[model samples]
Target chain A: MSVNTTPMPPERLLQLDDVHVHFSMREGLVRAVNGVSYHVDRGEVLGIVGESGSGKSVTARAIMRLLSKNAIEAGGRIRFRPEPGKEVEISSLPRDGRQVRELRGGHIGMIFQEPMTALSPVHSIGTQIMRTVMLHRRVGKEAARARAIELLERVQLPKPTEMIERYPHQLSGGMRQRAMIALALSCDPALLIADEPTTALDVTTEAQILELLKSLQAEMGMAIVFITHNFGVVADIADRVAVMYLGRIAETGSVDDIFYQPKHPYTRALLQSIPRLGQAPVRRLKTIPGMVPDPFNAPAGCAFHPRCAYAVPGRCDTLVPEVSLFPGDQSARCHLAGELPEEAL
Target chain B: MVGYITKRALWAIPTLVFVSFISFVIIQLPPGDYITAYAAQLRHGGEYLTEAQEAAMRQQYGLNDPILVQYWRWISNILFRGDFGHSLEWNAPVSSLIWERLGLTLAISTLSMVFTWIIAIPVGVYAATRQYSLFDYLFTVFGFLGKGIPDFLLALILMWLGFTWLNMDVGGLLSPRYESAPWTFDKVLNLLSHLWIPVVVLATGGAAGLIRVMRANMLDEMGKPYVETAYAQGLSERQVVWGYPVRVALNPFISTVGWALPALFSGDVITAVVLNLPTTGPLLLQALKMQDMYLAGSFILILSVFTVVGTLVSDVLLAWSDPRIRYA
Candidate 1:
């Protein structure tokens, strides 16, 4: 028998640089996404982690140009190098223009958080999946149906043939999520933006979905932007992690570095807040004190300064910390990050 | 689904009968009596009829019976023999007279409904999609104006325009020339020319109301997450709004179709009189005014049946369209 061989590593896919998305409200301009930058290599899973209102979702929405009318992209660019020779600036693409339409589903597919609301209740799942497949691929109905059934199987949904005929309401939450995944993968997109794909799922289902996504990435060599507030999920699936604090990227590193040696005060505080099984129950868990500042009226210098435990009096409050690269393949935005006293190892 | 329709149809019989009985009682309980009105007219026109003869006429027409008995007899006649009794004033069978007028009214109502849906759906979808734009504002203003003006006033305006400017006759279903013309293409055109005004008057307010409802529903459906999901799927904007949202939003509009039919049909009394259109609405109004109990009561009963049937048909249609809706 001839020897089997592995496929070549896929190329570097998406690079976002200094991306800033703002929303204009009555109070002021809310900087929903501020200077967020990350790159996804082919088949790499990049996780963006933060609490609610930290701009993780906004960053994803900005990438997709799915933000509301009031939202403004103030700065930076999203560059997509589709193949070896082709590259395009995603940020410059008009929202409703033909190029953006071609990019969506054809190049960059997205899976939203809530599967119940994401699938149209009126249409059957087969019709919904067939629509995207036929529209993007110019495939005939018979071939699209075969592809949709294949996708349903790839996402690990049971009874693929029968499930395709059912409505969204007929499926369970986990199954609906899987169906959404199948829809996203219908076009065989290069970059898959999963915005809290597993957030609404139960713990067991979440673990299964994560495994399925990991396996699919291995098979297809698709880059993924996995946005979530759950650090545990990031720890489980992400090759690299980006921590967002009030729209800005507070820290960026490999998963191991960010979890064990988080340098930014906000990142450290976020990790501490995850209740461990061995930790004793307390009256209140180790929550970072104070709420995230209103994005419309974000602080002048460090947005997280008010809530930071190790905040320097004037340094943290008045001067914006530059994102500085550290020694161990990590970067952080904090005035005294490198100079902090080392804890006993 | 067949079982559901059967159950609904079975339930509708009692409801229709109850409505007919109530309509009969309410129309009869009013001040004037059909026999009295007929006798007074005869006396005024120099006809010699004795009081005994009038009493005999009342007995012959079953007017001497108690209110409940008369209602029972009327309902029984309709149920068993399909008889609506004879008109005291016109001396014609109620069924034939009512049927003639009912056909005209129904034709106008059907045409108006067709026009209303054709205009309203597209305008509504456009308005909702282009919300806050100049076209939306202009259509919204027109919608409000159409709804604000009464149907009769609209008819009066059309009459004035047609009579003074175009020198068009403002009466009947067609010109006198076409009344004797053979059933040909030219006669159909003549009939349609006379049919235009009443259809427009009846349909304009309905179209305006439907557009408002359709616009609101379309807007609400557009904001739903599924719509955004459609867009995110790389489907065209047209597909997102029309393909998905329109079908979902149409449930409410479909259900409203039944109620709109009867209202549009029977609600045209004033408009009918203003245009001198010999439709059921004006006929029913004349019947009531002359206290021709059999004619008026039969017309009321027919109107009630139409209302009930309209609602039932809509409910069944909605259930058929949406699996989520059940008719238990």
Candidate 2:
């Protein structure tokens, strides 16, 4: 490994390698994240786009080793390199162990969809943020308080001093989200996992929160795994995009490559379905046909075969397609991704 | 907050008046007055009262007065002078009989109430966090059984069990040896030895109810985003479970405990009788049965006040615990 020769290949903070997360159910097993694999480099934003149950959030929780008790992430390695030379295998650590606790909120932080529910109603915003600061850092109460107020101000929440004394219910939705973001960033984690954080806000508030997050990411110089279903959100903030369908990566590439040159049929169908701003009006927005197959009774091979317009019947219906690699860390889990002529669709 | 409390306290006045009137009327509605029962008792004791003598006795006792006038006198004495009138059967002041047993009743109720929470909260929290585990299922079954069994029946069974297996005296607030003895360390020990049975009997049903309530409450709160948020902050599972969900689950529990305040005087009356405990519950039952109007009325009135006051206290505690409540 001639590592010293080539500008040290921008260090990878987190790399999820062929991870599989399944949940045990009374009826059967739910394969939430099936052979999912991706990575985040230092100070970069990786957008994970998917439907509600497509396992984007599950993947984020897998990286944090915070899956629910019935869930098992036993199949693959979630390697995290928080520092330059050190590596911690997150998937191997016990979900509720002391080691995971030290890793969470210190090396990685997460914010959720609904800020009102995510923030505790009983504790003041300051107490919530300050506790995170104090948990990871050896700081006195006053110092933690100072850091909390600073973080609150950094998120641009008005009235930092007054807001610190206010509970989550006292704030507006945007304000609560800002406070949550402040809490997540309290310990200065190297990576932040924001899982549809703007989904619950009004359009203006969502825009505000996204803008705030973009600015904060720029200022802190930390990697972000932003999970969202909104294509607009992905286009606004993502450097690289991973489009997921039925718990598998459909296509992953640079933002331009995903929007302009989608290789997988699922990704192409998703792009055609959205209502773009300048496009001519149509009778109806194109929606991908067929329901997402139930997790308990997933189809035999390609989970998306029933819905893929370009599915090769025998190939996609029986043999699961391996991820075909491409240039520039891009790939697609479809049998025909690399065939140049099929990219026209 | 002070103003809010003051407003609630003021509302209790008319409520007390209404309660007094209703309880007074209900006590009077029974087939006969206390004197009628007293006359029957005298007849059974081989003392004959002529009709004229009975009339003279009723007039002398002011029983012939209008019911409203009698009610006025009773309520006036209680309000202005703290006089609960007289107990016709006991030939003593109503206050004296009530006071003698009320102190003991309050102590027992408070202890059993504390016991219920101490046992229920942790057990409920544990069952919820370990949802479908062995202890969760066990407590769920135990909770159902405790709720289904009648308090008096449980008391009888426990009494028998204590005597047969433990060879322990299971009845009354004290042993026969310590019944009339002055307060001493040995007497205190004897009292405590007997105290546990009543406490356990009284606590069983309440503890069962609270455990189920707390368990359901914790289950609801545990899955709320805030608990996950706490864990996402890298908190240990213990800290995450105890810090937010447990605290939220206590809202209903504190209210239940507050409602138990009125149970101080009259909870599980039959159980008290079965155990032969010297508490207010049994005394109240006897008073009601004998149509001891003053004594019965006083007991009901006091219990009503306790209930209203208990609700007020619960509201205040809830506000203190949940910041969102202050706005509401």
Candidate 3:
């Protein structure tokens, strides 16, 4: 194959190709991320939207190679393009080895959901942030401290200098989240994976954090894989959205394609469930009927068939739906999503 | 933080006093008095004391005083004048005898604690990280064996091994060579050489228990999201294991320090007797058997103080290390 004349090489920062993550227990194996595939471009915020148990966090953890011992990556490849120069295989990287250590905070960084428990209780904010700075960057203590203060200020923390001396427990939820963000950005990583970073915060703080992440991503030009179950958050921040259902991507498209032109029945039900502001109150809010099928005992056909309103009676129950391209350049996995009634649209 | 430690230290005084008082009452509860034991020994030797002679002896020893008054006097002397009454067995000042033995016990206990922690922490952390691997399984087996086997049996086994395999003396802190040159390097090394068997035996059970505690604590800490966060922050596996979980696991281990202190300080009475090392544990046991109230009471008081102080120190250290902890 000849080298193609493609501009910017599509700037694919991280790509998961047909990834499958499963958990083996005494009972059975749970297919957590079943054949999930997606690509995060440089400086782009890719939102993984789904309800609880949709494998959004698992997908993010798989990218970072932070899965538990029970979690078996049955099949798939996670490749991280650190910069314009080289692409590294994340799945095959030797954990606890020197090579993985070098790449961890140097090329990739991660922020967890709960800030209360994320930071070390023993260390002060300054020391924790300084540790990352000194670890990756060959900087002295004084320089790292200065950089830590600067990073704290950049994260919109109050009194960055004084706050640095205080421990994580001394800070409120928003402050701790900011400190976590500061720690993540300290090494100037090429990829930032935020796994429900604002879920534990209040609504107002969540908005501020999301906005902070967006502004920071724009300034740093780092590809971010933002994991959340909130569709409203995806609407406000995602460049592209991947909707997960029963450990598989039911739909993947541009934000508009997902929000305005949803082609998957699961995605449509999720959008309908969102409590829209200014809408008249009703006896019961719209909800996707039935719960997610247990991952361990998932159905042989489409996992969403039991709950999908647009399910084709025999086909949806017997045949596993393949991921197929829809009309508006959107990808969906459903037997009759393209043939929905006009009024339902 | 220093102020917090100081406050904790101050609070320990009252706690120690209460513990000492209870220990004193417990010691006094037994029917036979120190004078009775002395009287029985005299009778065994066929030197029967007349009623007047026994009364004079009791008066001289202040044995006729009420139990509460005697306790108050003993406590007053210890707290105010630093005098710990004369021992009925050795006829030497109880404080002096206790101090000499205490210095030796302190050295052994300190060495054992250092050795146990150095060995246990790493082993526990390893077991936790490996979970059910071969190394973890081996340590778990060893840990259970350590916990189940009696301390005295452990000492006897060590002593037998020392005598048969190593051609070593199974006894006390020093060899006969130490009497000539007390502070020489050779004496110190010789002392340590003899000191280790008992210390190792005494510390083994504690170390094993600590390893189990540390393993459980580390496993718990490892499950905490903070540990995962540390790994996600790109810290090395060593950093995550030693840095995050180890520190948090210290909390449980620190609380156990109080319980371990007296056990360590005593240096395992059976081990001391089997090895013939004249540590305070065997001496205290002998004192109890002979009903040398002053000797036993003073030793018990010292041990109580040590237990109290050791716990306080660990608590303060824990508070200092953990930012979430607050001094009340």
Candidate 4:
């Protein structure tokens, strides 16, 4: 309960309490997001960092109920709290029900990885954005058009009027991404889920998109769930970071804490693997050994044990580690979170 | 865009020439000329064509000239005089013979095309969106059957059904009273009454094949990220299906228009024979059977023009509908 006096602890915008996502395949069930839990506060950016199969995107899609037909939310809850004590369990709602439809693009918006393919090539940029605006808001066509042009200008796309009439194929990659961002923000959604929005872009363009996103977040005061495989990006934009491995969160903390004082071996290995600029040209980049375990039949205990440099023979191979929280609101799901050596390599 | 269209039009000229040349050469490839076949037919019918008469007929028809000379004569008439020569069997101008049947052929082919697209687009979209559903499976069964069965067989079956159940004539494009009559309301009504059977038979294969193509194209488009982006925008299922994937999927289908022209015509021929419809298909078949090179060549030339024109139209439509293709 928020005390009238205490600065009502910045409202919890969205929360996921131990969510699980499973996809049924002919071969076997893929446990994509296994007991994953995290939350984003108002105006805060939470970066979910993971490899391709690490389930980061799956978690983001789970929040939006955008998983494919074969996917099932095996367990857990995704609760969105618009205000204190007013919660809607996203996991419990029917996938195609009107409630979820209203929640998407009305209260929540998403931008995808590839800008070229994310925007429909057959439609003009203005039409796509205006449709989104009209879908969520009761507005006239002229008003929606004005809002679209405004959003395009806000995203810093040049020639807003002319560009609105042009198709996605006419724009450069960065401009296309800007247009996509404009579409996502047309409704001024409360929560924005960006699934690797800059992965397909060049570094300069990626940085520009990230900068644009940060400024937009500042301007709109909306929470962002930024999913990516790049740690450098997480360090740049995220206030809090959640490092995922094998469909579970291995470590989560403030950006500084996760980068400077990583607790899990996987997180430490990930940090060491980053190719520093000043390193010797002949030296190979340090890589964590062993592949991610097959999802159909994951290892018995710690999923990272096979790849962890400091794996214990008997204990780490058998007993799954429970999430251990540290003093500074940081947590790591590792058996020897505190006892690992300082050096990762 | 005008420049592009002009370029396309200019390109079609050479294509048509090449097609006409090939058709002429292939039609001339058989061992004997129309006179020889005519004499052989007369012999079989217990009559005789004297050698002098055959020789005179050959000379008058330019059959005694070199093959190159004959080709030049044919091509020049088409290119400079706009004349397609005379039909050896029908004893009329090839142009008039073609004109006599062009109306019905175009009507049947056009109607079949319209029927095909009208059925394929929506059903294909449905199958793609609800893949693996019972309706999709059932539709797939129909598609397979439609694709596998020959058009002539389908015509026969439909004709049998119509005669047995509906007591309808089911053959020819018009009733006896309207066969050679002017284009009046009664004739039009009679034509309409008889048109449905051949149209259904002719359209089945194309419609079924197009449904499969459309379904595949739609499935591919559905997997593209733009579709997911549309959904994420909270567009309804109907809006998303129609707006993004359908538009993108239509590219390949539109490109098929060029090929569909020739296919519809050829398919119409067999169906026409089976149903005894008064279309260019039966005329073409008869001309080929009689070794009437000009008549057969004219049919081939007309079909070629339809193909080239169809391709041009499809290209223009593709450019207009898809911005990616347009800019490229």
User: Best candidate per DockQ, number?
Assistant: 2
DockQ (C-alpha based) per candidate is 0.64, 0.79, 0.69, 0.64
Q: TM-score of model 2 relative to the true fold?
A: 0.93
Model 2: per-residue lDDT, tens digit, B16-62?
Answer: 78888887787788787767877888999999878898888889878
**Of 1 and 3, which scores higher on DockQ?**
3
lDDT of 3 by residue, B181-293 (tens): 75988877888778777668766777788899889988888988888878877788888788888988888877767766776666677766766765788888888897787
**Candidate 1 structure quality by residue, lDDT tens digits, A1-345:** 111122223466877788888888888888888788777887788999988999999988887778777789898888787666787777988887777788788888899899878888777788899999998899999999999899998898888998788888888899999999899888989899999999999999999999999898889988899999898898888999999888888999998888778788788788777776666666666788998777778897898889887888888999989878987669998887777665411
Residue ranges of candidate 1 with Cα displaced over 4 Å: A1-10, A277-284, A343-345, B27-73, B79-81, B165-173, B176-187, B326-328
Model 2 stretches with alpha carbons more than 4 Å out: A1-10, A280-284, A340-345, B31-72
Clash pairs, candidate 4, are none
TM-score of each: 0.90, 0.93, 0.91, 0.89
Q: For residues B1-328, write the lDDT of model 1, one tens digit per residue.
A: 7888888899998998789878888777767677677777788989866889878988898888888898888778888998998898788999888777777777887888899889889999999999989999988998999899998899888878988998987667788888778889987887887888888987888889888998999998888878877888877788788888998889998887788767755757888888788788888888888778788877777778878999999989987876556422
lDDT of the structure predicted as candidate 4: 0.87
- The CAPRI category of model 4 is medium
| Candidate 4 residue-wise lDDT, A28-70, digit = tens | 9999988898888988999999988999999999988889889
State the fraction of real interface contacts model 4 keeps. Answer: 0.76
What is the full ranking by lDDT, best candidate first? 4, 2, 1, 3
- Tell me the whole-model lDDT of each prediction, alpha carbons only: 0.84, 0.87, 0.82, 0.87
Q: B191-250, model 4: which lDDT tens digit per residue?
A: 888899888887788889989999999999999999888888888889999999999899
